[model samples]
Target: PEGSSLQACDEAARKLTEMILKEDGVASISTYVGESSPRFVLVIDPVQPRNNYAQLVVVAKDLKSRKNLEKKIKVLVEEQLPNVQSYSRSIPLGPPTPYPVMIRVSAPTDALAKEYAGKLKQVMLENKNVTMVRYDWMEKAPAVRVELDDDKLRQMGLTRKTVASALYAEISGYSISQYYEGDQAIDIVFRLEPKDHQSISDLGTMSIPTAKGAVQLNQVAYLSYENEDGMIWRRNLLPTITVNAGIADGVTGNDVTNQIMEASKEMRNKLPAGVTIEIGGPSEKSEDSLRSLLGPVPAMLVIMLILLMTMLKDVRKVIIVVCTAPLGIVGVILGLFLFNTPLGIMAEIGALALIGTIIRNSTVLVDQIDQHLAQGMPRLKAVTESVIVRFRPIMLTALTTVLGLIPMFPSDFWRGLAIAISCGLTVATLITLIVMPVIYCLIFNVGNEEK
Candidate 1:
């Protein structure tokens, strides 16, 4: 497909546009042949111009219609345009990758990398969940190679340069002179008309200009057809060929990537020196996002602990409050499960927000218990009265926060975060009101004596 002519890509793009335009819910479609559409919006990174590449942008009536049309178009492309390799996806919300599953195979030489890429593509195609398996380095394109004979060139009073120049001028073109208009100069190109040299045989009989006389090109050279690489991809100066694939319905990118890694163990072991393979795409992006999110967590926690220790002045109470934060994770898990939401980056952020709230509630109850103790109440009375006094405020605070998050539940981006905060806070507040008092009573030996 990479070696296809520009005309071929243009025809395919037009055909695809016609098919998609017939589908319901599609408002309009733009087709870009031999290149991608311009950067209409900020997120779209346009594809570079290539002889074989084409892109289509389809606009739908609404969000619901768009989702449905995406599925239908995918089916249509596969069933109707079997010969054209195609992929359909909406604009990505996160970092954009060419495919869901990308396996990068790098080697010292381009040929070695491409060879492994083909092998890797075969391995990926074996998985039932992996579809549209292909490599960036496509099949080679046909090329004409001219081999000149030095002995024949000398005998004919023509040099290799003269014959090559004549062949180039006939096949492509020769810039004979430049025409100047104002300060701009334009190339005056010249070449034989298409009717004169319509085939390769005509090239062999072309005449080469020389000082002595014009000589036939066939006496000095030979022409043959061979295949050469259409394109090459490199990463960090090393040739890297990435084998990318799409996942089937009801499967995650990570699941298929893991399967491919496990299946390719034998192939990996057989890799030659200076060759390496790595998993990329969504899995790689996810790991990077997680790392960036978690990098500052330890420092933040240390600062929070220092503040907690300074406030309570009691290691046991500080430990109790710190320990209460993680228990909220149970509620977070339950929240995601009950709401049918995946625990994504937004959800993790909501869980982190729960930590501060839990610590705040625990500190308030503990401080109130101390206040009662300072006012000459017995330890048991102090623990009991603190819970009784703070219970309404903590419960009301959680209820109000949960109600405030109701509007976010319907949004695809913030739904997970909303669920995590609402559910985790509700359960964590209960733990703080009930468990905080009990832990206080036990830690201070309050329950051993009623008086």
Candidate 2:
């Protein structure tokens, strides 16, 4: 179906439109024939125009309506239109992926690329978590290949260009000259009547005009029917095929991608020379985003260390504060588990912010202890008094921060960040109030110091 005519694709789209209109919550549908819709949203990457392709942009009433329509439309298309390939999904809130799982196979030639693409598709289909697995390039369509006989052409006093022009005029129209009327110019074309060149057999029998007179095409050439790729995808001019799939409910795309990767170890080992396979889609996008976000982390940590040293002026206290920073991981893990949130980029950001919060809390407590020691208080009293004095302020700071994040919990984008900060800060506060003081006393030999 990849090489289906525009009429066929249009009919399929019309039928699907009828089915979709009957569903609830569908407000309107804009249909684009012979191509994908124009880019209206940044997340949507439209495909190029092809005779066999049509796209529909469906609108729903609200968020709840959109969610319901997404599931219903997917089922409707899969069940009622088995012959047609279709993909239905809601516009993503973040980076867009054509499918949840996309595996790309690239090779030096199209045949080898398609061959391994099929193998990769089979591997994906074997996994229970993968569904609707398919590749971008569909089955080859029937085509005609013409091979001109050079010796016969020369004997007939014909050049390859003349023969090619004659064939083109017979099979499809060839513009000869222009005719103007009423300020408009129209090309005068020549082509055989539909009945005369409708079939491949007719093509071989078409006449070509030469200096000698008209000669049958088969007299100087060969015409054969063969299967050729309907569409070819390439990356850097090397043939590439992408096998895409959807994941089952309740499973993340990364989880299924990892599973498939593990299962295909043997397949990868057997891959032909010059062929390479890799995973793409959501996982790849997320990784790229995270890498960019984490690029400045080491610099930030170094800057924070410098600030802490300048403020506290002691390596012992700086070590105590820095060591306490990672203790918030316990809360991050526990919070995500308790709230059923994923440790996504937003949550990672919150964890990073939590580090600054933890350091601030610990620095205040340590600086308090330093102040008391400077005032001639015994080491034991300094450590004990620091914990007692910082307890109320630390707890209040964490409480207010957690309360402020309550509004963000309802948002899909900010929920992870909110949970990470709220939960990590709560735990980090305890480390500052309790753990930091204990570590400080231990490092300074408070118990053995002369009282």
- On TM-score, the leading prediction is 2
Q: What is the TM-score of candidate 1?
A: 0.86
lDDT of 2 by residue, 1-451 (tens): 7668788889889988999899889899999989888879988867878888888899998889888988887888779877788888777767867888988899999889988888888889999998789787858888888999999999999999998877777767888899999999999988778888768789888888988789988888889989888778888788889888998877878788889888888999998888999888888887888999899999999999999999888899889999899988889989999998877888988988888888888888888888898999988888888889888988998899899999999898899999999999898788667788778768887777755
Candidate 1, lDDT over the whole model = 0.85
Query: Deviation in angstroms for 123 in model 1?
Result: 3.9
Hey, what RMSD does candidate 2 come out at?
Answer: 3.4
Q: What's the residue-level lDDT of 444 in candidate 2?
A: 86
Per-residue lDDT of 1-451 in model 1, one digit per residue for the tens? 7567788888878888898888889988988888888877766766768888889999999999899988998888788777788888888655667788998999999888878888888889899998688777757897777789988877778776777677788778989899999999999989988777756687777888887778776667888888988778889899988889988876768778989999999999988999999988788887788899889999999999999999999899998888788868988899998988877778988998889999999999989988998999988888888899999998999999999998999988799899999999998888777787777777777777775
| Model 1 bad stretches (over 4 Å) | 150-199, 202-219, 262-270, 449-451
Most accurate candidate by lDDT:
2
What would the TM-scores of all predictions be?
0.86, 0.89
- Which consecutive 10 residues in model 1 have the weakest lDDT in total? 39-48
Task: Go through the candidates in order and give each one's C-alpha lDDT.
Answer: 0.85, 0.86
Residues forming the 10-long window of minimal summed lDDT in candidate 2: 442-451
